[model samples]
Target: MIWNLGSINADNFYDLPHLPGPGETLTATRFRQGLGGKGANMSVAAARAGARVMHIGATGADGRWAAQRLFEYGVDIPHVAEVDSATGHANIHIDPQGENSIVIFAGANADIDEQMIGAALSEARPGDTLLLQNETSGQVYAAKTAKALGLRLIYAAAPFSAAAVAAILEDIDILVLNAVEAGQLHAATGRELDALPVGDVIVTLGSDGCKWISNTARTTRLFPAFPVVPVDTTGAGDTFTGYLASALDRSLPMPQAITLASRAGALMVTRRGTADVIPDLREVQDHDFG
Candidate 1:
């Protein structure tokens, strides 16, 4: 089982000729909406990847649909709460080149508290997996609680927060980061990425592929990116992390899990949108990585 403490967002997408410049107003060529949020994305991905996922989050009246959407995607959401604040949301502007610019509003996503976290975690047993991201509050409490309960913790350091990562570093078993965030974390801690004390540090290098530094073995391995043309790169990292977590939870070897995750992520970029586009296990299993 995977317990995800994360944000839920309504993703508003606008297709544009190019990203807007400073103070420039441009009309979108197309528009659509869907469920999103780094936390939400990971939970959906893990669920679709065949893990049982429990989502711990909050949504306002207007964002009730987001929670419902998560339920529809196979994530268990009994712990999701209805709060007073509006639901979180993101405005994603995509270009023909598949690049994007985004702005986020954190609403009920910031409403997570210890009560909600404690209650949700009470249902967990030892050795269950806990997934966390920076988009929501109570990460410190969640990390500590999960550790005390003997759950394995996988932390995806995105929208990276130095202080948050620093606060829970000792509790993390695996750390996931993309290239830029890895560099930022390196600068923040004044330590190389390989020097982190976590058992596994996975650095995603975009099209160049990802590298895994294993502290236990004192060795590193590389997994090359599968060949594919991207239409929109959104949610790829979340998909990778979610699938990776699910694979590990199933007792797959680390190298096999990373490779399977690479395939899922490569397929993710080939589609447009956010959580809606995360490929299910069957799709990934049937995909041609060539």
Candidate 2:
């Protein structure tokens, strides 16, 4: 099972012709509400990719709907707790060009405590992949504990935080992030990507491709993404990271796993909405990884 320890939010999205500048108000043509949050998004993506996933996070009193939404995606919500607050919400703007700008209200997500973390880890065991993001502040330590309990830890170091970045250097099986995230870590530690003091790092470069140091074989390689017209790139990174975990869980070799991940990311950009847009294993198999 894949365990996702992060935040869950109810998202409100508006479609504008273009993004507005700071303090500027713009009219939008359409509006929609759905499930969102780093953890929720990645959980749905992984579940859609055919992993049996468990999502652990908090939902607001009124926001408990987030759990229902995640359940619709086949994600287990046994550890999703509801507190005396509104479920966290994201105010998002997606322009005609598919660029997105979002403002988040953490609500119940911000109330997650260490006790919640312990209860969540109680459900995991060795070899199960614990997929974590930066939404929850203290969840990093719980990830380490899961690792100690034999879980293979795969972290997506997004929206980098100082403490989280510092914690990532210890015993992570796979550290996944975008190019900017990769640069941030490299800059912070002043170490070559190859010399980073972790198990392995995968730096995703959007349309350009991805770079990584192989954990098993210890080889550095780069893979270019297959060209496609991207309709919305919102969850491409999540798709890649989730599929990468799924591949590793299935015991695929590194090169084949990267290919699966790259193809999954490429497929995600060809659609809209993070929840329903993720590609399935068959779709990934059909994609040409050229």
Candidate 3:
């Protein structure tokens, strides 16, 4: 089982010819609304990849529909609570090149408390996986609780907060970050990727692929990305992280897990939309990359 203590957001997407500059106003070529948030995206990805995933977070009255969508995607949501605040949301602007810029409102996502974290984690057993991101509150508490409970804790250090990473670093078994985030972490900690104390560290290099460093083995390996022209790169990283965790939970070797995740992420970028667009396990298996 995978327990995701993450955020749920209503994603608003705008297709644009190019990203707008500061103080610039441009009309969108297209607009669409869907479910999003790193947490929600990862949960859906994991579930679709054949893992039993339970999403633990809070949503406002307005966000119930988003939570319902998670259920439709086969993610367990028994611990998602209702809060008084508005649901979190993101405004994503995608340029013709598939590059994106986002503005996020961390509304009810910020309402997660220690009590909620504890309650959700209490349902998890030893050997279960706990996945986290920087979007929601109570992450530090969740890390500590999951560590104490003997769960395999995985942290995706995105939106790259030095302080948040420092706080939870010692507790996480695996740490995943993108190229930009890896640079930020190196700057913050004054150490390179291999020097991080975590057992495993993965640096995702979007089109070039990903690198995996095993701290315990003192070795590094690179996995190249599948070539494709992306339609919208919105949730590609989340898809990778989710699929990686799901593969690991199923007892696949690290190399195999990374390969499967890479395939999933590559497929994700070829499509549009967020959580709804992640590829299923069968689609991944049946894909002919030749």
Worst 10 residues of 2 by lDDT: 136-145
Order the candidates by lDDT, highest first — what do you get? 3, 1, 2
lDDT of 1: 0.93
lDDT of each: 0.93, 0.82, 0.94
Q: lDDT tens string, model 2, 1-290?
A: 88888778878989998999979988989999987788888888778778899888888778767799889889999888888877888898999977788898878877777788788888787788888888865566676678788988888888776578786667677888898888788778777767766677899999998987865566889999978898888889988988888788777877788888899899899988886667888888887745
Model 1 per-residue lDDT tens digits across residues 1-290? 99999999998889999999999999999998899999999999999999999999999999989999999999999999999998999988989997888899999999999999999999999989999999999999999999999999999998999999899888999999999999899889999877887999999987888999998899999999999998878799999999999999898999999999999999999997778879999999999777
**Backbone-clash count (model 3):** 0
> What is the lDDT for 18 in model 1?
97
Instruction: List runs of model 1 lying over 4 Å from the truth.
Output: 15-30, 93-101
> Number of clashes in every candidate structure?
0, 1, 0
Q: Which digits, one per residue and each the tens of the lDDT, describe model 3 over residues 107-168?
A: 99999999988988888999999999999999999999999999999999987899999999
lDDT of residue 260 for candidate 1? 90
In the order shown, what is each candidate's alpha-carbon RMSD? 2.0, 2.3, 2.2
lDDT for model 2, on a 0 to 1 scale?
A: 0.82
